[model samples]
Target chain A: MQGATVATYDFIFNGLGLREWCGESVRSGPMTMADLLARGAAPAEPQTGFDWGALWSLPFPSLDELHKACAEIPRSRDLTRSLEAGFLNVRESLRFVLDPMTQPLSWALENALHVAVNTPWWLMLMALLVVVWLAGRSAALVGLVAAVMGFLLFVDHYVFAMQTLSIIFVCAFLCVVMGVPVGIAMSRSNRFQRLMIPVLDMLQTLPTFVYLIPLIFLFSVTEPKLYGIAIILYAIVPVIRLTDLGIRLVDKEVIEAAEAFGMTRHQKLIRVQIPLALPNIMAGVNQTIMMSLAMVVIASLVSAPGLGVLVLRGIRNLELGVGLMAGLGIVLLAVILDRVTKAALARVNAAASVARH
Target chain B: MMDRQVSIAIRHLYKIFGANPVRALEHVRAGTGKDALMAQHRHVLGLRDINIDMRAGDITVVMGLSGSGKSTLIRHVNRLIEPTAGEILVNGENILEFGETRLRELRRKQMSMVFQHFALLPHRTVLDNIGLARSVRGERRADFERDALHWLARVGLGGQEGQYPHQLSGGMQQRVGIARALTSNAPIMLMDEAFSALDPLIRTDMQDLLLELQTELQKTIIFISHDLDEALKLADHLVILKDGSVVQQGEPQEILLKPNDPYIVDFISDINRARVLRVRSVMDRAPETIPQVAGTVDVDATLESVIALSGGDTALSYAVRNRDTTVGYLNMQSLVRALVPTQAPRHGNRKQEKAQPAASGPAA
Candidate 1:
């Protein structure tokens, strides 16, 4: 049966003129009586060599190789592989340009992680409560954060939670530092705004996993900045978009008033546009924090030390309790960050409302 | 008033609004009408050949219906809106030639504007809003704040300095706007429908306040308004606009007594003539000898006031006096005739609506 199959494939490949293109030695396998009979009967009917008869059985010899009659086209799998190879070819130059520019980010992430882990637990807890209080100024919020941190410490997951938070803090801060000016530039120039929209859309809609592939090639798996870059790329879109919208939404008559008063362009931007856009920028910051926290778990695949690493270990060892505990820790951390940022945003909204009223 | 030197002289100034304003301007200069130019070249004729010599220390009111470009003409004085072609000479220097810095200096030191909508900054305190012009010039806060506070008190908004604009009523907000203009210490005040957004009672109060301020400051003021009543009440020199072109311009009383164009006749036909016409406009110039008169009336007295003095007796005549010296005679017949407006042409409403300016206009 194996010999008969090989002979049939040889006949089809030869009939379609693709025998040499397929790169296979013709009929090298051992032959059986069925193969020998097929070969012997092949030249008996010379006029019927193309098989016009026998419609039900072997009506056409080259049916499997019909498209190969002209030329062999690259398949979908080949197209994807070649694209990756092409990207690899330019990786050296890209790394040369990007490595120096982004070196500081890796240092920042490493040092921030080291600090978060080495700090005394009591001091860290106190500092966390202080930050929450300053942002929210509400007793309820401060108590909530204190309770969640206490629970994490009780469960011995405090270090992992802090690692995740440290990563988020560094990445989200950088996002705001870079995103706001871009948003301002977008708001001020129509041409710049038109150019930036598609880029923002691509960043927003791209699958979360797809970007990680290129990022892995760009930096070492062990470097914290590999995930830092990943988190920043994933989280910067909202702040930029919201800031642009906020500035553009200022009342037209107010701008006219500013111009009528003979305000210089810089003076107007600082005194009028930025202040009015603050509430929106705050909201963007809130969104960026939430997004960065979500990205930290995915970032753990590249050896990021966090609660995500615990979850990955549980999955590998099939330890159900460990996985569940780490997952709960992440959820608690997310709630803590979300509430803190939201409370700050609410305060800004209140101040802005007072101005409007 | 006649001897006062011209503060802002707009000569052959034209503003066409479109992508190709300069090309459209050639058609306008060749006598193509506003509507025709719009239809043929898709350009709006904002102002056409506007020529006015605004005297220092006098209120020059540019009156027009909506779309008549009174606001456009006023903006040219400050170079807020660039003209397609023309020269605006402020104090004998062509302001059109001023570059960005010089133009800003002109707006900061020589011209200040009050808007129809009180465009006070919502985020700023009333005091900061009042000091906007000085603040933009990088003046020390302490230096401008004192002047801002003084004007604040003068405009009747004292002790409201700490409140944001949204915390105040519309009338009060506009008072802040007026004070802000005053704080700039600019010699030329441009009021672009400054009181049109207020209630009728508030509008009247604002008008009175502006006139009171004008009497004290004697600034070269260019006031734009659609209301004929406001124009006649405030204008020392009135320019009536029709379809982006001036139809008649002179003393408000003269424009009322001798309307040079049919459009002006139609415009003034609906006005309360008794309230606007003055005895000086209707009275005969000083004669060699005075005729017998029932009583004397001031040259500036409204014709309605003279009617009350004469008891509606057409046979009675009054001596027109200027500070107790007889200047002319006002017969009751001529006063009565002046009170009766000239009949407007029957088919003028369509043209009136088409000429309505986009900013706003008072009801006829």
Candidate 2:
């Protein structure tokens, strides 16, 4: 309190009357040895030693730290606390609007997890191979998927790997389903794209922990949607951004040709823009899958089930073997997904360029 | 073969590209120049007071350098780019007042366009691209396949129909574009620099193909180009633009013989005039008594062929025949004189020049 001083910023903010929200009151006097001794009646030993080597120190609470300890100016921490409070104040309203809208997402994640875990390992492997074949049309990629699944099975991490994958599958699918139309809407309108870019930039650049803090307050930890929502929010950005970019980047001459041929906006979008943009969209999907895997592991901090759970347990119990094995399992799963999607992307690229020749 | 009339008539068409086009239109109407309008008001005057009557069953070529707004003018006929102010009449109907549904109907059923870049859809096969306008109208492939294939064969792309656009050379791709336009069966075809992207030999071939098609189809085609030779070859009526305004427009031969602007003089300066000027243009109409002639040449024969016919003899004269009917007499001397470019009248000398212009004409 004795160190409190009214700086110019404090005077300005005090004139603005922001003290009630964040400011502390100023004390009556500055500190001195005489005042300390008079108040406590303690005897002091005087040392008349002077240090000549002293450099000129800055005044207390220099301009750089003016807002740190001022009475009238709001501190950085207080400003952030108020921001959190403002968001919390609307939490009930936000939940009321978002809960029923998002309850299906929880069910989708839960059912997918349940179905994946209960399916016989061989059947799941067969189905995964079929999906891989369908996406890639490459026998080598299909065999790669089979080998990765076999390795995970042999390591006894099959169930945990399935859990992580099932969650990723549901989330990434939902991201594409929801993100593409939003990206289309953005590409069609300049104002919408302008409005969405900052939002997308913030979603991409914000720390994973910052958003998780609010989600934890908004939903119960036990809710499957807590992590599903987290994974979706973190992974959906690339797909949306790339979809918009892809559509916008279609050849202007082609677009003009479409218009000159009297194509309706919808007809042009469906028949021309989307077909041409498919390769870029597929690349976005690949990035989204990779991002979903990354976010799922981080989401394990909030009780998201998967190999991440084993990794968490290993960390808590200090079992290096458990941690390393789970880590290897996640890495293998990531490689499988990455290679499969990349193979599919290559197929799309080839088809697109085949005609370009 | 068919009655020719005005197909697309653009009147006082003005297009200013900027945030406030209406305000800029005021400056344009006040006769503010294109560059000045840009410098003073930050608005691009894309087109200014363009009035041209594109005739039915004839190719009206709009020729200009890039940014002279020839492209902009063509787009306006299709309403691809809207005008800041104007009237566009197709078959005497003002298209500028048409609603979106009516405009779409007009575009879908009455007009189709060819592009400079041969903008065939890369994803679609050549046949599919040819059938695009019909497909956009929700027509089944079976419904248009016969007609589309007919045009495909007509454009000499029959076997290549299954190939993509990129598989075709630039000339071949534009042939596909032409086939697509023909398959639409629209009477009005807008070609925006259609043959400009082809090689010289291919361009000549395309020009011949277009002429051959025009003789058969007789559609009202509006062609845009920057090349004077192509314009002379293809244009039934030539409209030349400069700085977003029409410098002069008329029969190509008439414009060549009587260029009204210095800009046009410069544009036609380097042209091989002997190849483009015609016997009919430099001939005297219905002489009282037929003069001694080296030969009779077709009314449409180029002066170059006529020169070769007379062996460059200045004393030789030829009778001009229009389909076996003697229409005029072309003196080789006047033909040689017509080969010389017309002098562009400079400022303050126009009135004096106009008083003496009867001597400079090709009429003997």
All DockQ scores = 0.37, 0.48
Cα miss at A343, model 2 (Å)? 2.4
- Which ten contiguous residues of candidate 1 chain B have the minimum total lDDT? B355-364
Which residue runs does candidate 1 get wrong by more than 4 Å? A1-78, A150-156, A310-339, A353-357, B287-289, B344-364
Q: Which stretches of candidate 2 lie over 4 Å from their true place?
A: A1-89, A353-357, B1-3, B344-364
* Per-residue lDDT of candidate 1, residues B229-253 (tens digit): 9999999999998778887899988
| Steric overlap count per candidate | 4, 0
Error of 2 at B16 (Å): 1.4
User: On a 0 to 1 DockQ scale, where is model 1?
Assistant: 0.37
Candidate 2 lDDT, B1-364, residue by residue in tens: 1356788889999999999999999988887777678899999989888999888899999999898899999999989898999899999999989998888899999999999888778878899999999998889999999999999999888888888787788899999999999999999999999998889999999999999999999999999999999999999999998778888999999999998765677678778999999888889997777789878999999999998887778998888899979999998888889987687334334454356543322121
lDDT of 2 by residue, A23-94 (tens): 455523343353355456544334367633322432355433455335444444557778989999999999
Candidate 2 whole-model C-alpha lDDT, 0 to 1 = 0.86
